[model samples]
Target: MPQGPNGYDLTVMHPFRGARYKDSVATNGRYWAGPLTHFAINTATYLFTYHFFANYSTEYPDGFLSEQTLKSFEGVSGERGSFKWKHGAERIPENWYRRQPGNDYGILNFALDAVGALQALPYMAVIGGNTGEPNTFTGVNIADLTGGVFNAATLLEGNNAMCFAFQAVHSAAPDILKGLLGNVVLAVSKLTDALDPILAQLGCPQMAKYDKSLLAKFPGAGAGL
Candidate 1:
């Protein structure tokens, strides 16, 4: 039987998949016990959690990726120097020391910037950047670039839909049971949205072509990668 108007079944959807992956580290400790193991496991776990959470964050309810103000720390070294309190004495002239930018060694920022660069490649190619013209580069073509765009856009749409749906249900739920039911709905919606492209590629006719009318209703639908 269907669980909602969308005919989605909630039983198979795993909304807590991120939490499960995080928990698995503790449950299966042997897998994360070697050198660089923590790095590998934590990377995978954080990726999943970030994907599931999408743009939602308790601290930043409006969105998570906002422009950060660059912080300056010009006098850090002199402030922490050993001889700063000597009366009438020139504070240690830490000429070799310099203030560091907050994002100077931000690993997360570097990774995010790299991903952003990769995502912009297709657009750059369209605007005459050297992504290799169609048939010019052996084994590389425009379809591959467009397909990547399509897949990325689909995934983004899925994430957005999941976040919007979750927020709607979460806001209206009056009690614990209703909240649980809302979560179930959210899980199903998220799974279905995410799998739509895969199912379409697998020859599901209904999933292959999106309805133009529906697209009119949802502007984000136009961003079909």
Candidate 2:
């Protein structure tokens, strides 16, 4: 397999990789340099957004909910069912879920490049092999071309846990981000409800993708998002 029909490892980077701050921080240039730092962005994003919407709304008009109080609600929604859709391949149709927006909407699409980067690292050891097995990595590991290669030809791991967890903390991260955005929506929803008896306001309402009109409940007594 070659190109140039032509050049081998010429190392010429495309110009588009050098983009703006919000963009490049994920894909082309992201690195913790180590494990401890790999998903730092996710934790930070989760803490902040969770506080703003989840933590804030639960206690507002009264006080803030203790951090321990809210953990009781994580992923506890009662509605549950089995997913029966079976495609010949794992590919999902574009309309099936909320689509990702922007170039680096998640953690940027590193694609095969991420595997190449891992293979090149001389330190810390390689951990797995083909068929998801682990073996002693040899200097010849590159020739096998296996590590992260999903199809034995390419690696498509742009949405690793670290990447997804980071995106989940932001409103831009689709419905799951709602776990945090839910707070803000709840806050405004309650504010709208409490004020419905007398005052009419525009600022607090169904805005953006979240319908303020739909989130009319505050879970329990004396809580407002």
Pick the lDDT winner: 1
Shift in Å, residue 203, candidate 2:
42
C-alpha lDDT (0 to 100) for residue 149 of candidate 1: 33
Q: How does each model score on lDDT?
A: 0.28, 0.26
Give per-residue lDDT, candidate 1, residue 66.
14
> Which 10 consecutive positions of candidate 2 have the poorest summed lDDT?
216-225
Q: Across residues 186-213, which tens digit of lDDT does each residue of candidate 2 receive? A: 6555544654432222111211231222
Q: Could you give me the TM-score of model 2 versus the true structure?
A: 0.17
Going through the candidates in order, what is the number of backbone clashes in each?
0, 6
Give one digit per residue, the lDDT tens place, for model 1 in 35-95: 0122123333433322322233344332232111000111222322341233444332322
